[model samples]
Each structure stands twice: as structure tokens, then as C-alpha cells.
Target: MRGIIDLNSDELPKIQDKNGALKRPPAGKAAVENLKIDAAILRQSLVAQAGAEIIIYKDPTEAVSTGVLGDVVMMSKQSYFETFEAAPFALVADGGEVTVTPLPINRAAIHVDATGGLQTASGIYGLRFEFSRATLKSYPSIEDAIMHAVVQGLARTGDAVLTAGIMAATPAAFSLAAAAAAGVRMSELRGLVGTAGHGAAIDNNGVLRAAGIAAELSPDLSATIVGSFARSAVMIRSDVEVVVDRTNIDGSLAVTAWAGLQALLPDTTRFWTVAA
Candidate 1:
């Protein structure tokens, strides 16, 4: 008895092996990991860039307490307290009269009104390659585009917050001519801060442009970005979130970050104008 041969076995049938059916390839794990690393690096770079532009006060002398208040956040400020003088007591030489001088009372009180609300600075970015012609060509993947957008947004947010804080402080002004050195703008900034009784200084491109006392006097003060934090400094707390959607062929990504800017001593902060 001859066994029957199935011709259909050799022929490519419409329905192949049920167990070996063709399916879409799963997304690669390496690709996802690479994207994550790139995104983190970009985020960090942006943060540093923003930090350089603005003065963030994180003085070790002061203390910052963080807490939540309803939908808002609160940061309590405790000023640095110190007393250098000692009691009036002097060593007396044998048979010699010792002079006694009254001790001076020096007290640096924490400003009761120093308490401030943590101001929220947020940046949001969306990456939709289908809708973005520029991104589609420039970025190798949607993740790359999303990362760049997120970084840019975060940097901008930081810059804006710092700028506003400096403006509000409104320290005194110095002259560009009075600048200690030609290339060193920070020196001039230091002078202004010293005059305003602040110990710290911030000099950036924005400050350079704002250079001028006349500009500072204007109702819309627009002097160099130089300013002083006075006895206390500006503090910041930040949080970041990122999301990616791979449900469709044309996927999307989104990133958001929030930074809270609070002054250690709201009343102590001062801004200055740098004049030519």
C-alpha cells in the first residue's frame, strides 16, 4: 500500500503553519533604553544651563523646611542667627586694676514675614512627529525629538523664574565703566551687591543687556540681569515627568517639569542695574 503524498505541502498555502505564523516584530529593548538615557542627559544639561543664567541661593547657613498646603506648597525660612561678642570679663593682673567694657547685644532676628509660598514654574512639551515637519527630518526617532523639546522647555522655565525673582528684588545699580575688569562682569555685579548690603552676586547675559541705571529707574525696569540675594538666597525644588505613547505607528511623547522658587528671606533680596 503506497502512502498518499500531499502536493499542498510543497505549495505555499495561504494559511501557513499555525504555530509559525508571521507577526509584527516586537519593539527592541535596546532602543527604549537608549532613548531613556538620552532624555535624562538632555534634561540634566538643560537644568545646568538654566542654573548658570540665574542665581539660586542655597546657602548652608539658612534652613529650608518643605511642606504641602492644600493644593499649594510651602517652604518655611529660618534665618541664620549668630552672636560674636562675649560677656564683659577681663583677666586682672596681680594688684593691677582690670578695665571692664560693656558687652554689646547683637541679635539678627528672622524676619517674621520671611515665610513665602513656593512658586511653581512648569514647562510642558509634546512631540507629534506627524504634525511636526521640522522634527521628523531632524530627529532619528520620536523619542529624540521629544527629548530636545522637553529640555528646551525646562531651561526656558528656569530662566523665566530666575529673571522674575531678580527683577522683584530690585537691588541697586552699578556702572559698566566702574566695572573692575573689562571681561569680568561678575566683579561689577559684586560691587553692586556689596553696595546693596548683599553678599552674593549673579552676572549673566541677561544682566549684561540690562546694564544701566536709567533702565532700572524706568517703570518697566530693564537693567542688566545682575542682582543680589542679600542675607538669604533663592531656593528651588523641582520635579519632572515624561510619557511616551507607542500605541500607533506614529507615536507621541510628552514631558513636563515643575520648579518651585522660594526666597530664603523675601524682604532681603535686592536687584541692581549696571550702567555704562
Candidate 2:
């Protein structure tokens, strides 16, 4: 195999432009690793089309909770109690005082510990690609092939996990078989109940900016498909950083992409499945 390129050491060299001054990173700046892959490369997944949030903490060791930390506001009176059933209430005569239970309007509650299956279990999925040093040099660019390969894997498994989480969150699958032609408001369905602040906690999910509800196809569930799940139903968290491992004698390389994924469906009422 042609000589392996060790970007950290071999690829970079020292050079001076007349003044004898170093043209390298100044002070505390670290040279670019050029190893990490952009998440955008594989945006053709169900999670991506579903308006899922991708959380990426800056500090690798910044430390984060396993479960999602979020809150939900009581949209209706039923939302305040354990048995959440939408029932009708009669109006009393004007000024006719009657004894009735106190109300908790727009009650806001926090969920650190998951109640029921509203939050899915957190699992770290790894996508790895191992190739010979000669194979890497053969690509138009090493990062491109690795990024595309690993992300495609992510999108596939990510769907299984996402579908599983939603199925577990609710008793039955949220179907959109008989919905409007235009589909429903993406956020309305997966808002996870009302959020005065919880929305901001998870990057407002991509739905906050997502143009419209997309649909799900047999293969790719991206911005193009007749998308469904159509809003922020699932969340994917990862630094999107690539970890490089060197093979001993073979001089091959393994590029890996890591992510912590979870399905959050506190209240799936607002969501509707879309099929196009």
C-alpha cells in the first residue's frame, strides 16, 4: 500500500514567508483535524425528515444527562391530571356560585425522570467504516466517502430506533392514512405537549424552522419525500465528531461516527402520519 498519510504529523509542515514568522494557528487555536464529517451529508433519513433535533455538545467532556430534561405546559384541564381524557364541562349559571375543584391552568411540569414511556431509552449507536490506506487515497477525498458511508448507516438504523421509540411511547401507532391532502402541521403533532421553555432546551428541534411537513417513502425520508411523522417526533444527539483508529500492521484506517439517540413522544396527539 502507498505510504499512509498521518495528517496530525506528516501532512502538516513548517514554512516561513520572508518574515520567519510561523503561519500556523495562533496562541490557543488548534489545527483543524479534518477528520469530522458533516451531518448534512446524510440528510436522507426518516429522523431528518421527521423534524428531529440533533444535539451536539461542544465540549467532548462537557458531560450531559442520559435522559432528556424538558417541561410541558398543560394545554387543557385534562392535561393537569393523571387520567388525561378530553371531556366536556358544563357552564354554571352567571354569578351562580357552585363548589368545584380548583383548576391548574397551563400547568407546567418538569420531567427528569421519565413518566411512563414518554421518553425512550438512550442508546449510543456507532457507525464505522474500515478501509485500506490505499483505498482512502483512491477516493476523491477521504472524508467524503467515509462521511457518506457512515451517515447512510446512521439513517437506516436511526429509523428502526425512531420507529421503535414511537411505537413504545404510545399504545398504538399514530397513523395519517386518512388525513388531509396537505398533511397536518408538523409541530402540532410532535410538540410533546405545550412548551413555554422546553422547546428551547432541545435546539427547538429542527421543526421550528422546518418549512412544512414532509412524508415518508419506502427508502429515503428526506425533505423531498411525501414525508410523515412530519415533525419533531424524534431526537438525535451527538458531537458528530469522527474518531480515527489506525490499524497496526495493515496500516488500514477505521472512521467512526457516534450518536446518542432517543425518541421523545410525551404527547403524540398533535402529530399525524403523512404518506406521499
Candidate 3:
């Protein structure tokens, strides 16, 4: 296992045998495979999900990122809900001349009338992160941290806005919690299929399939009420701006990004808000 050292070369990695050559190891103890360099290190991937988005109005393209910050997209303040009614047929007696009733399958649709009008995605919402130069060097994936911060901050802010809007619009009698209920049911919310649970547990907000109203926890609403809502209830987003400062007054690298976010409810009535 002992071999001559290639000490003459200036490179630390180069074999430094007295002859300036890296001596190859035998296929045993000092073998190159012993390092297992191929699988020695890896960085984890981080992702974030926003419940607010589940109930918000969105275009198909909004989900795909072009590797660019994005551009302004005009969205409508109004949407429509359409549904079909299934009719039942009676089994007619042996039909020689039985007058069979024609099934009348009626159709119904409603204009959601999102009344706020087209909103400007001009509201600024963002966050700044700073790390000392040395700290950034030592820590891995600050990029992921930055992206996650933006998403979570945005989500929390949007939820607060949407919940506040609904609360403000609801009559005082129903807005404030007189007492906590066992749970809010889809039937209670008028067939809306959703649940809001957070500050409280399922005891207050029962479990349901991930549909109806806001399918996920309404970050702010969970504390007071639990109900599902129509999907076209909210709208969100806009352009992004990122600023990086390596030359800091305190020698820390600072990262900052986009603002100009919009959280608008077309029709608050489309939402079901009640005391928990």
C-alpha cells in the first residue's frame, strides 16, 4: 500500500512522487473507487404551494414559467358558472301505447358578476434577504430560500386580503364568531365544496374533498369561519424586479425582488362567509 510521493509538482492534487507524478493506487485500500465521488454530495430541491391560488382566477399559461420574470396579462373582472340538471325517467308499463313523458333536462347558468372591475396589478408586495458574504458561501441554495420567501410572503398577504374582503362585506351578525361550531358543512355553504381549517382543527373545520370554494386553508379565515366558495372568487399577480447588492454597507449580500401584485375579489357574495 505504500508508494513513492510525487513531491516536485506545485499542484496539491497532482501526484507528488519525488518524480513529480501522481502515483496510482492499487485496486484495494487506496483505490480511486474508495472515494465514491460520484454520490458523495447532493443538494436538496425546495418547493412551495400556495392554498390561495386554488381558489383564485388564473389563465392556463400562468402555470408555466418561461424562465423570464413575466409580463402584464389582462384578466376579466367577470366570470360565469354553468351546469346541467339530470332528469330521471319513469319505467313505463309494457308499452303498447303508453304515453311516455319526455324527460325535460333543463339547463341553468349564472353570471358571477365580479364587480370590482379589472384590477391593476400595481400593488407592491415583496421581501428582502441579506446574508454576509461568508455566510452565503457556506450556506447552500440561498436561491431556493429567496424564491420560497417570495412565494410564502405573497401567499400570506393574498390570503389576508381575500379573507379581510370577505369579512368586511359580510353582515356584522354573521362576521363575528358568537361561538365555535362543531364544523361547517358543504350543505351549510349551499353546496359549495371546500373547507377552511388552520388556527383551529377539524373539530371546527371538518374534512372534505379538495374542491369547492377555496379547496385549501384560507390562511386568515380558518380562525373565524370555514366554508367553500366559487372558484372565480379571486385574482392575482404581475411583473418582477430583482436587485442584488454584493457591496453592502455592512458587508452582506442583499437580495430583493418583485412587487406589483393584485388580490381582487370580483364578487364577495360568491363566497360563503360565516362565524366558526
Candidate 4:
């Protein structure tokens, strides 16, 4: 028979036997109960997930210009990892067969055993944009005001990126009438375009006069908006929090995107800069 212990003794009850050793419980019952306190502390030790959003807008005028200026290729991250190769030279001959040996000296060096064989060379250039980052912050304010500022800021940033990229890629695409001058004469711009074999029409203020190309030489300055989105992982949470016993509301938005200048032909696309 098992010995029974008194519950009202001065000593606390023990789960062990007389030897002060622990006694095993029944099968699977030997595990201790998990203590889950339902009580909430009065301190502000709680953290709520942040709620922030981001939006992007492109300029309408620039959006329409893409068609005539160039081609804008939307590239995935995987595609961006790949390298761009250009074939600048090819050999052709009138003979039935020809042997060609490429000299290691320079790109222009090519040895051909057959006469009347012609080696034509063209330029091939690779282009890619470096990664960039932008951020916008808003403090506690009217919801409408905060939204307005954010939208405007996003549009301005996008426009600037697109403009800079285009200008960098094709510096000669548009000739500046004068440095540090606004409102250039239409006639001067026309003459410059004509000399370049581009039939671009310009307004009095040197703006592209049309959204479509009037001639083969003219590039349309119109553009279209491409993909734009907020980076959720980098966006800050929009929420009210107490810091140093003061209540404050703050939020931020982060974005990553690619702005491309559209062109009819990728091979013909030139990403160069000319001195002002």
C-alpha cells in the first residue's frame, strides 16, 4: 500500500518521496504545466506593426516623348545581371569561300586570305543604369496635406531621374541654344536639328512641337511612364508612438524603380555626353 501524506503539515508539500527525491508522474504527465500569464503590464512595452504607403507619378509631357526619342526597355533583376555584348564587325566576300583571321592587335585588325573580301565595322556599346535610392518623410499633419506633399515629391523625384538619365544617355539628342539661358529661339533649335539630319520641330521656347515624329531624322520627345512601386521592406511604418513620454506621429516611404528613355532601335541607341 502507498503511504499518504498530510496536507496541513507545517512543511510544504513535495512531489518527491521520503528521500527528498523527485517522483515521476504518469505517462506523458511528468511535464510541468506551462505558466501563461494573462495579465497586461501598465507600461508601454507593446509595439504595433507600422502602416506606411508610397505612390509614384511621372510627368505627363515626358511620358508622351518616349515614342520618338528612344526605346525604354523594362528589365527584370535577373536580366540586369546578364551582360550586354555588341558585335561591331562582320566579314563578307564575293568569293565562294574565304578564310579570315582576326589579329589580336586591335578591333580594326583583320586578315583575310581572299581578295575582294570586305570587313565592315560598327560600334556596339552596352548601357546600364546604376542603382539609386530616394526617401520621403512626413510628420503629423492633416491627412490630405501629407498625401499631397508625398505625391508631389514622388512626381518631382521621378521626373528628375528620368530627365537626368535621358540627358546622360543622349547628350546630343537635344542641342542647348545657350548655356544658363531659358526660352531659346525656335529657329536656332530647328537649324541645329536640321544640321543633325533630324527633322524635329520646336516651339518658340525650344520645346518639342509635336508628340509624333514628322521626319525620319527627328526624335519625338514624348515619353510614357513605366513601372513604379514602393519597396515594402524599406518603407517605414506609419503609426503613433510615445517617445520620452511625448506622443508623435511619423511615417516614411521608400521606392525603387527604373526610368527609361524610349527609342525605336536598341542598337542605334547612343548613351554619350557632349561638352556644353
Q: Which has the greatest lDDT? A: 2
User: Against the hidden reference, what TM-scores do the models get?
Assistant: 0.35, 0.45, 0.43, 0.22
Least lDDT summed over 10 consecutive residues: which range in candidate 4? 39-48
RMSD of each: 19.0, 14.5, 17.6, 29.7
Instruction: List lDDT for all candidates, in order.
Output: 0.35, 0.40, 0.37, 0.23
Model 4: per-residue Cα lDDT over 180-248, one tens digit each: 132323321211122233334555665543222111121222321111111011111111111111122
- The C-alpha stretches of model 4 lying farther than 4 A from their native spots are 1-141, 173-276
Q: What TM-score quantifies how close candidate 1 is to the native fold?
A: 0.35
Which ranges of candidate 3 are over 4 A from the true structure?
1-122, 171-223, 247-251, 270-273
lDDT of 4: 0.23
Ranking by lDDT: 2, 3, 1, 4
Model 3, residue 86: displacement in angstroms?
15
